[model samples]
Target: MNVSQTMETEEDFLTRLHIKLYHPQQSCKGLYGMLPLGKRSSHPADVPLRLGRDAQACTYALVDPRVSRKQLALHAYRTAQSPDMLFTIQNLSQRGRLSVNSSALGYLERMDLPDKALLRFGEYEMLITRESGEAMGSFEVEFEVLEMPPSRETCMCVPSVTPVMELRALVPLENDETLCHL
Candidate 1:
């Protein structure tokens, strides 16, 4: 197939990426909500997603005072490295700290995310998972064949060696040439 066709195949396998913010069931007095990133609910997937305690960030509004106005930002898009969507996160909080699976993120630092990455901001924590149709589809197509070189020598001929004296007693050889003396 042509270059465009190859890319189109890869695109079809990629799913749209999004973040899922799951509130601890007991943290909000049993009144909890999960926020999925998208534009329909004012959560723009293409733009930097603003998250924090500010009521203005209705897309991902957190009521906890410990969360800064803009604690974290997420940007999602299709990446050329893999057939699955990738995401990058930016720490926007001044006092709050951000971490992915226990790895701390510095202020304003951006880092690519992996599947099922756990994010923590102050007292809140969320899990990031795929949100598109392809995420649930068969993953067999995502793998590419990798060509590797042979690991050992490939000689086919049997090595030549002198016949032992014990063998000569059982079956006599007329000449050393017949024994493949080389």
Candidate 2:
């Protein structure tokens, strides 16, 4: 089976446990962690048991065996090479509030994140604003995992189109006023 087919099977497995799954196309190389939220009354068994990140940084969803249907939120954290790098949150639903908490606050003052950088959590898209006081951009995001069809026939050997060739050429150099040969 192909990559798409594998994705479908994984999605099926997650759905069986009633967990809302999201597949992120972006790489997770710099991601730190994710906070998944569910109904307060729900038991811990309803939470996702595993979260996977591939070598290329794609994120996959896995659910606990006992989870049931419920509204949930995921706070995914990421790290970058430098503070100048921007972080973004996008493709949120049109319901609920998105909140952000930073690790630091100034003396006698709470460091407030710029409104533009703060995403409302439920919008279609949200971004961490640029440092120059500009609004962060947004884009529509969608994910799909499909199954691969079984192969009807198989082939073994394949022929090469072109034979390998090796060649060497002498280098020529130019002098200040005349062409020089090396």
Candidate 3:
């Protein structure tokens, strides 16, 4: 296939994505520990949502010193084969890695997202779920964003080291290391 046929532009998708919160059942810290759970945010139409620490560039600015400035891009799309809107996600962070549904994605890597996807980077995690409420054959897809509870086993704020038999193991980050603390 030609480049034009294979690589479609944003306008080709012909759909928009809105990220909202439907239920606020649980209480938990959100982005930067300030955006509480279930908080709602609007997304720009005809453009991918930029998420990262760079407020000037990113649509969703996360507060994380350890995380890179420009992290992820979420693009909404649709095809002639299906009326339902789909999405493609790209990893923009140069230093940090993005794990989508347990699949690791390095810088510049992208993947076609499923209906429900869990995006994890560093100590932060973003949950995007598709909600179809339309009765028509052509489904209208809306997405919801939520912050998942931090995993205790992999908490970065407080580095926990297991007791080791050897004294060498006691010395952690022997010379230098990069880690997120809170």
What's the lDDT for all of these models? 0.51, 0.24, 0.57
The candidate that wins on lDDT is 3
Q: Model 1 residue 115 lDDT?
A: 64
What lDDT is reached at residue 164 by model 1?
60
As a whole number from 0 to 100, the lDDT of residue 62 in candidate 1 is 57
**lDDT tens digits by residue: candidate 2, 1-182:** 88986664322221111222222322333222232323211212222222232212223322322111121222322236432212223322223333332122221221233323322222111233222211112111222221211010110011123222311122234422111122
Name the weakest run of 10 consecutive residues (lDDT summed) in model 1. Answer: 148-157
Looking at candidate 1, what is the lDDT of residue 14?
Answer: 42
Work out candidate 2's RMSD over C-alphas: 22.3
Name the top TM-score candidate. 3
lDDT of 2 at 130: 28
| Candidate 2 or 1, higher lDDT | 1
The TM-score ranking, best first, is 3, 1, 2
User: Model 3, stretches more than 4 Å misplaced?
Assistant: 1-39, 133-182
RMSD of candidates 1 onward, in order = 21.7, 22.3, 12.8
